[model samples]
Target chain A: MSITRITVLSGGMGGARFLQGLLHGIAAGTVPGVSPGAEVTVVANTADDLWMHGLKICPDLDTVMYTLGDGIDLDRGWGRRDETWSVKAELAAYGVEPTWFGLGDRDIATHVVRTQMLDAGYPLSAVTEALCRRWQPGVRLLPMSDDRVETHVAIADEAAPSGRRVVHFQEYWVRLRAEVPAESVIVVGLDASSPAPGVLEAIAEADLVVLPPSNPVVSVGTILGVPGVREALRTTAAPVVGLSPVVGGSHVRGMAHQMLTSIGVEVSAAAVGLHYGDRATTSEGVLDAWLVDERDADQVDRVRGAGLACAAVPLMMSDVDATAAMAAAAVALVTDRGSVDGAR
Target chain B: MSITRITVLSGGMGGARFLQGLLHGIAAGTVPGVSPGAEVTVVANTADDLWMHGLKICPDLDTVMYTLGDGIDLDRGWGRRDETWSVKAELAAYGVEPTWFGLGDRDIATHVVRTQMLDAGYPLSAVTEALCRRWQPGVRLLPMSDDRVETHVAIADEAAPSGRRVVHFQEYWVRLRAEVPAESVIVVGLDASSPAPGVLEAIAEADLVVLPPSNPVVSVGTILGVPGVREALRTTAAPVVGLSPVVGGSHVRGMAHQMLTSIGVEVSAAAVGLHYGDRATTSEGVLDAWLVDERDADQVDRVRGAGLACAAVPLMMSDVDATAAMAAAAVALVTDRGSVDGAR
Candidate 1:
């Protein structure tokens, strides 16, 4: 099928980067069979969201919005561009807890607007839509779920403050730097959450589904954990292709190795591709094709042997052009081998 | 009586300035008989407080805290010193309403901390106290009432779709600049709101109670409008004395004239004194004495003619010493003639 409608299951930084390249590709008419008029829908993971100091903060959704809208702090790769730290400093001075997270002043404006809307009886999905009227991220951006779903990391605590502390994902990643081993990744409230408005519909109506090299466990993985999402992928007539976040034996960025280890998944491209499995082999499985970096070429045959069309390409998104090339490769991989007949 | 506990029913700017000078007087041992260790307990008006963008902003309470803690913007006489306006600008950029309030970046920190605590099931008074632990305002600061009480102004709207407009006190004062004629000053929920913890107790145990030269109608007047507060003042053994915010037939600062005019009280020093009324004459009266500025000294006798001892003093609070001198004159006004016999 000619690429027209594309849906991406996304996380924060890595997912945002891929979407940027994909948008660039669409705009430049360079993303394989995809044209400039192609509509992209991003279903961002809200499992990474947390309420801090009474403000609802959606790191993944904001990342996709700010990054795509050209408002992201380029250096930080998460918060707003030209952000100030006055609010954060004042918060620290007041000795409010969880001071490790750097909440930029410019970023806080988004939170204030969001929190106000939420308090006024608007759900998270509606709030995101209202906020997007400003950012104009181009693509239809929808949160994974309107219900509160927080990713908590279980870690061994020798201090025994609570025997073993299950910290919020941010505290684990930002504060602890994911240095300590995580026993498990707990996605609280995700199992009970229904897909947010337009989420399942976006997936169902899409020509293709792309999983950019986001954290398989926390980012894209948690998004899949939401009920009806994985089911939509299984039931959709469109092809589903994924680019491996795991390059060679580790993540290009972030602590995917730590998270994968915690979740009892192997830290390799082939292992991750197999973990997603083949739609032909398992009725519950969703992947039709998987792309890995050139360095992981040796694992391509192994990934293919598991009943999914697998390809090795240069997947480092150094810039928009390079990332667009990766996106193009992803589109070509799915189009060539993940066509309607290729499902067999 | 050795003045140990001093309670002041205060508004924002004017009350804050008066308290600053009062503290200075106490520190210098110059307020008639008040010593260095004199403890001040301020009952601040919560009527001016509003929930903006999901944050509880206590203008008067914050004014007292910021002023006493030396964090206030001296030039603006409100908000934190050396403040940035990034949040305010961002809010405006997002097209959030009532952007005229000028919430400083540093000042927004106060609101955030307050909002967080309030969301976490703490009362406004507790949140204020928790926030004060940082500023160390050196006085017991109590919100006039823990309950929500908003001062809304009724305005004539000849051109309105509804033919009338009722705005929050901030909307009237900050946005409108109180330029439009206020039809009535309505203290919503005031009659239903009981005094906050330590409010009535602070009044009952005080050697002296002061009505700082804040906006008498909206600020101090609103605090007295709280259910138990006015009754506490009427029954307390402490001499209840007030200083005139009006000078030279006009307010020294702020919109006292407009609010007084809205409530049908004359916008003059003597009229304000009589408006509080003679404590001995009426069962509901609350003020034992009133002081006018030197500019309105001629009206002092007219105030005394209303069955209360009155005095004229320099009230411009131009500097700490001048303000301390004014505070001294106020203390002396109540101590000398507003003693037990003065009530009779």
Candidate 2:
């Protein structure tokens, strides 16, 4: 079966990097059963969105757009390539709060445009579409939901009356560096947020769906927490597959290990796959197959025992070619499983 | 008489340059009969204020602040000295409107702070005061009024249905370059605006009031149009003096000639002085003494005949020292005229 339409659930840096490789593999006709001309749709997590200095910032959406559009700062893995920080420095000089989050000058233009449109009553999805007109990020990028969904993390605080305090995910991740132990992950407004326009439709109409190696707890997990999003994934006719963010019991980049730990999920490749679960057995399951790294081959059977078709390949995305090979392996894994008869 | 508390009604570039010299002259003790430690208060014209790209831009206020705070671009005579145009370039690439107004990265920081404060329910005066905490622009800079006041110019547009078009002051000045013939000047909200906090008290308690070499019609005239502001000036106990922005047969800089023509005033030093009129004769007059330029020395007698003390001096603001000499000349002209007891 040839897949011409593919949908991917994404986060920031990790998801953006994975999409680049996937697109490269498809263009090179190396992703086993996928068409070279496949139309990719990205439903990105908005839980990491923030408002700073009165401007709305969508970190993940901008990451994907800038990365694919060749405007990303390659060294930093974010922001504009040749960005200036005059505005950020000036804001700090003014002694405003949250000076830790650096907003680049070139990036501020995007936020100004978005804030203006959002203030003028355009939804986040529409604003994203309008912004995409400039970046033309190759894929159809839609926010997970139009309503505000912020990820808040509860961390133990010795001085607090309750012995714990909740902080915005950006405060925890960007400011605090996610070093402190988090008591729980609280996704405010996620359960109440409806899927943004075209989100559910993209999933239901896709030939296949792939979950990139984004942060499972706050990224892909937050998207699934949106009302009707998990149900759409569970019932979609297309086969669903995912590559492990974890390899040898730890994430390669980002604070995914810390986030998973906060949500009480084990920091292991097999545990992450099992956490997503198998679509054939449970109503909550969404993935048809799970791909792990070669170093974690020992845990492949443990994931397979949960009724998910599992395989181990070289999942290290060192470069484009290497990541493309990982994408190819992921596609071949699902193709080799030979279609779960009654699941679809 | 040692005049200590000096109040000046000002506009943008010309006014800002004049204030620099006035302060310099006061510090150097070059101005005749003026205290070395005199406190200067600037009542800036807010009629040229504009809202662009969802940011409130007060051109005159920012010009005065940047110039006084040493952040101004000396070459351009406005904006920050080492400004970058990344945000402006990106905004142009985004294809948003009003691309004519170039907002630099450093300058946008000021607008961002101001916009954020204004959106949070603070009035323009309070926002300006808060911003001055950073700039510390020596003088107590106050907008003429806290109310929204915009200067609109009616230009003869043959293509318009009514054979004319009314454009914002910035559109006329910046975009159109103020080359076209202006039919009239209309100040929206000026009539309804009350003087900003401390504005009336500054005028009433001032030891001397100086109208700098700014655009007489749009800048000083707009402030005078604010109901109680003119009354305060007319009834103040201090001597009121003004320097001619016009020299010879035209204005030294800016589109003052075109603005004067729009209001049916002749573009000559003598006419501008007479337009302000002598405070001793008419209830409408606000000037106790008017100083014309040396180039227009022949017109000095014409102004003196209008029952006001008038003199001729070099009015060109070639540099700080030259402008300081001009400020001293203005101060000496008023001192030589002697006091008009009943008028004060």
Candidate 3:
């Protein structure tokens, strides 16, 4: 079963890094079953999108584009390499709000172009395509949905009458540094959002689908929340597999632990795999196989008990080579299942 | 005849430099007949304004604000000092249009704030005020009008059926470098534009009105083209005086020569002075006195013969001190006239 078409659900940073390694593995013909010259399509989460300084900013989409195009600031893991923060500083000097977001000068150019196109009646998907022409990130990048779907987190605020205050996910993550306790995660407009053009089709037609180690709650979870996206993944003639964002009892990166906790899910590898669940047993599940880190190898039986083909591997994306090996392991684990009946 | 309140109709660069000197002279009490702490109000031309990259750019207003606030790039006489071109370079890399106009990163902040405010339904005057809070450009700065007034130049284009092509004033000046012969100058929406709030009152209540050495046809001319602006100057009791942008049969700086020629006015100090004419002699004129460059002293009589007091002085803004002396010379020339009968 040579996987000729691969689709990935992605967020920023970690997902971008994973995709870089995945593409590297495919180019080197090192992935277990992916065919040579196989195409990859990314359905990136847009719930992290925001409007600042009157410019539309899609963090996840830009991260993927810049990372794959070799423009990512390697140290920061996001934003353009050699980026200058003149606009951000100037905006701060003007005493404008949200001075915490480090909007780089080069990055603002992307936002400006996107905002102008959006203002001119181009949908988010079309704007992403237009912007990709400049990055040429090698794979087709599509927003999970063209419609606005912002993630809002409710945090404890004694000053509020309701004893809670809701802030945009960015304000929670970027501004507050996600240190405060989140009471709940509200994905505004998520349920109403239809998947962007070609999103469902990409998933249904793909030979295999891999979910990178992104923040499952806000990133991959938001993508699946889009109407018909989960159904497409369930009904597709493809092996559906996911790598655990959690290692041990905490997320490797990002605020996934806090988010997962806020949603009442245990911040553990076995728990996240079971949360995504086994498509064979439950109608709500979408994963046929799930891979956890070697450190969490002790929990493999717990996930396999839930009807998912489970495996443990070194999940750290320390370098391209290491991440590529992880991708190979994920593919080999799902392909070794020998049938797509569970994915169906 | 101590001038306590002064109003100046200004453009970019040259006008800003002149205002700097004028302020210096007023602050240092070097002017012949000006009271201490005299307030200046500038009615800057917005006809040369253009919207590029979906950002509203008022070059002349920004020039005045940045110059007076000491944030201007002194060498370039415009934009923020220590500016970075990251945004501009990134935009060009994205193949966005209007690459000719240099939108510096720090300068873009001003535009972003202004654009955001404008989109929020704030008028240009209010937006200008909001921006000025940061720059603290001492003098009160006001746009000629809140209404959109664009200056378009018709240049000889043989490829067109009409043998002429109309372009934005910025495109004509910056992109084309004004190399092509301009057939006509059109100030779109000028006739319909009412003076911005406080514009008419500033002119009417001023004790002295100075027209700086800016482009006569485009800058000052555009301000005069506003519906009630010229009438306010014509009916105001304040004595109106102007400095010749042209000197020694050519303009000292800027494309005043090309602009004058396009408007069928000779590019000579005396011709520009006479073109403004003596307010006493014609109901259409707006200058009671006009000053020419020392090099054009021979043409002073040509201007004096047009029923206006005329003088020749060192008009080059070589330094702040030299420019202050020129301002002093202008004030003295008007103050020596004694009677305000011609001005009225």
Instruction: Point to the candidate with the largest lDDT.
Output: 3
Give the TM-score (0 to 1) of chain B in model 1: 0.96
In candidate 3, stretches whose alpha carbon ends up further than 4 angstroms from where it belongs are: A337-344, B337-344
- Please give the CA lDDT of all the candidate structures: 0.88, 0.90, 0.91
* lDDT for residue A80 in candidate 3, whole number 0-100: 90
- DockQ, candidate 2, comes to 0.82
- Stretches off by above 4 angstroms in model 2 are A338-344, B338-344
Report the lDDT of model 2 for residue A149: 93
Per-residue lDDT of candidate 1, residues B150-210 (tens digit): 9999999988997888999999999899998999988889888989999999999999999
For the second chain, the TM-scores of the candidates in order are 0.96, 0.96, 0.97
**Stretch of 10 with least lDDT, candidate 1 chain B:** B335-344
- State model 3's lDDT: 0.91
- Cα deviation of A131, candidate 1, in Å: 1.1
Candidate 2 CA-lDDT value: 0.90
DockQ of each: 0.77, 0.82, 0.88
Predictions ranked by lDDT, top down? Answer: 3, 2, 1
Q: Give a tens-digit lDDT track for model 2, residues B1-344.
A: 88999999999899999999999999999888889989999999999999988889999999999999889999998889999999999999898887999699999999999999998999888999998999898899999998999999999988999999999999998999889988999999988889999999999999889999889988889999998888888899998999999988888876778999988899999899889988889879999888888888888778889987877777889989989988887777777554221121
Tens-place lDDT digits, model 3, residues A41-77: 9999999999988999999999999999999999998
Q: Write the per-residue lDDT of candidate 3 for residues B211-230, one digit (tens) a residue.
A: 99999999999999999888
Correct interface contacts retained, every candidate: 0.81, 0.78, 0.87
